[model samples]
Target: MKSSFVFLCISATLAVLTITSAAPGRGNANATIPANRTQNGTVTCAGLNDQKKALEGFIAAFVAILFFGSNFVPVKKIDTGDGVFFQWIMCMGIWLCALVTQLVLSFHPNNNNNLNQTVPVPFEPEALLGGFLWATGNMFCVPVIKCLGLGLGMLIWGTVNCLGGWASGRFGLFGVEASLPGNEAENFSGVALCLLGVIMFVFVKSEGKKTKSNETDDERAHLLFSKKIQAETESTTLKDMSKASDDLDDSWVDRLNPKVKKIVGTVMAIAAGLLFGVSFDPVTHLEQSNCHNPQNGLDYAFSHFCGILLTSTSYLIIYCFIKKNKPQVIGEAILPGLLVGVMWAIAYGAWFIANANLTQTISYPIVATAPGLVSALWGIFIFAEIRGVKNLVFFSFACALIIGGSVLTALSKS
Candidate 1:
């Protein structure tokens, strides 16, 4: 027990360090934005805008890290004893409340029937995949937390998730495991090795441009000469090319190439997975912390409300900043956010019930591994991410390590 407490302390310290180290770098990343804005009072408007952007990035990253990191600190306070049912009730209430708030805020009071105007939902494949993956991940994690304990479960889960994220980006499953034995530590090791393999597979540069996948030496020479020749020939072609670029930028998904598109998809998948993995810990924490008082339901309620609001709102804000001049984009953002909110509430709620029927050590590893398998399968079949004999060999070794890690972690009595 004392050792467990010590481990927890170390984990907490590490979490803090990760956040601290990342924050300032993100802030400085926006330094160039200040040069473009107009001046105001004493401060340059550009500088102010840059500062705001930096601050927003910090807040977004901080909340994201908190959401992801919360898994280690299970809600040991407010169990409510009703298990999954309680989780359901809480989630349902939160969803309803959020929906109502969204409706109210989105509506304009002065115009006739304006407030009642329905939001037109887009055909968003990414949102669909995200919600489904997240829901599945949540269901799986209850079992993992039961088996693995909060700290180690989250660690391996996070580690595998990181690799799964990379695979989903380049050419792997969305968030599923491709193939590995049911062992947790080995599974994670597999994911790590797979990550290494992927690193070997792709040639990345500091600017994210140069790659081993480029044309041969002669082809490069020809391309460079052609570019110079084209530049000398006509300014009109340059203008036309710039116009074409603008048009491509207008469509939301057009900006994404296969590689970037996969990354975006994978990011959405992992966001859902992370949510699923951490779902039960908060409930468990709440149960342990607030079992003595009935009215303290508000504590758990407020915390979850904050969680949902933080995630959805940050997503909206970030999207707006990324795609400036498209304020109407918020209309399209509604459904996906709403879908995620609903799915999130339900997944977490259901797992809380599942936890009542099992031990955390038994439950968590299974949960963590399920989406991993799903992601791997998606990579192989749906996305056709893996190929060639050498790649396959590397993939197999990675799978073995992932399984070994999972087994070690799950069987840990510590």
Candidate 2:
């Protein structure tokens, strides 16, 4: 009942936001406005438009933070063995959600004229690069969770991801146009505060459930004996044993030394953060470059999702081959993986909208670090993962810093 209620609430909230965001004159460039004249007889809708866009951008950012922080909750208790297969399934869900979004935008009233002529949105293949980068980063999620726990791992990577993404847009790295806010000092301070908040998150210890090694000697022995009984011939038994051996080898990460494992996990988290931080580069490039004649950021959704699905599928195929057709496939993880993917897709879509309306400079810091606040709330209230006065104090301070930073960043845009 609790899960159902939460799901309904989330659905209703998303629906409301969708309607509010899609309201006429929200972000429509060709929106017709009433000509309210100022004392000097100049049209005064520009200020109103800017204010509306800013409001929409912040709303979209809030949605992004909420969904991104909670997307993995569905799979928290499910065993996603090895993660590769699960990721591919998740990408399928992402693609499906994007397809739905594409259809909605393609048929939007804005795209139709008085005669009902529909204007088609072109698919930009360059947007696929962003999806590829995101999928690559996502491949490390399971390992990071296993090694550092979700809270610590998310904090470390979230900090890096926030900084890298904000810097790229602020400075116009990778061919994106530089986004300079009205108040540079305030913007910089806001980002610094957000970073400090993320760092503080790393210090607040959580008592979440820990993962254990799946491989056991008894299980291997049982598999060997089972294979022997199922075999009709000695050659078949040998092949079965070989497959079993390959299955055991698939858990090589579990066999690493504890110190080495932590190091590997940290490296993977950093790498993922870098990849995630730059995942929007392709879209930003397409929008800014004259070559692509960029459309709305949402127009690239389908192609971007296509890229993610294709890349994840390729990785799964490679993993299957490496495992000698013995890949660890978790039967129960499929639905949860799909649900997580859908949630992620919605969050990412909102992120694209936020970037379009607010620019990455203002959106990056808030979108990236604010999710930590949402996740912390979940840990404290829902999962009971965080306890004790010290941790609560840290959480409170971190929330204050993050909220203040976001407010400053938004003000800087003015």
TM-score of each: 0.33, 0.84
lDDT for each residue of candidate 1 in 175-195, tens digit (9 for 90 to 100): 322222245454445444433
lDDT of 2 at 232: 38
CA deviation > 4 Å runs, candidate 1 = 1-157, 160-282, 293-306, 314-347, 350-366, 400-414
Task: Estimate candidate 1's alpha-carbon lDDT, on a 0 to 1 scale.
Answer: 0.38
Residue 15 lDDT in candidate 2: 44
Per-model lDDT? 0.38, 0.79
The window of 10 residues in a row where model 2 has the poorest summed lDDT is 19-28
Instruction: Please provide, for model 2 over 274-346, each residue's C-alpha lDDT reduced to its tens digit, 9 standing for 90 to 100.
Output: 8899889898887777543534677777889899998999999999898778788899889778877888888
Q: Where does candidate 2 stray beyond 4 Å?
A: 1-43, 111-115, 147-149, 208-250, 291-294
Q: How well does candidate 2 match the true structure in TM-score terms?
A: 0.84
The total of clashing pairs for model 1 equals: 77
> What CA RMSD would you report for each candidate?
24.9, 5.5
In model 1, what lDDT does residue 109 have? 30
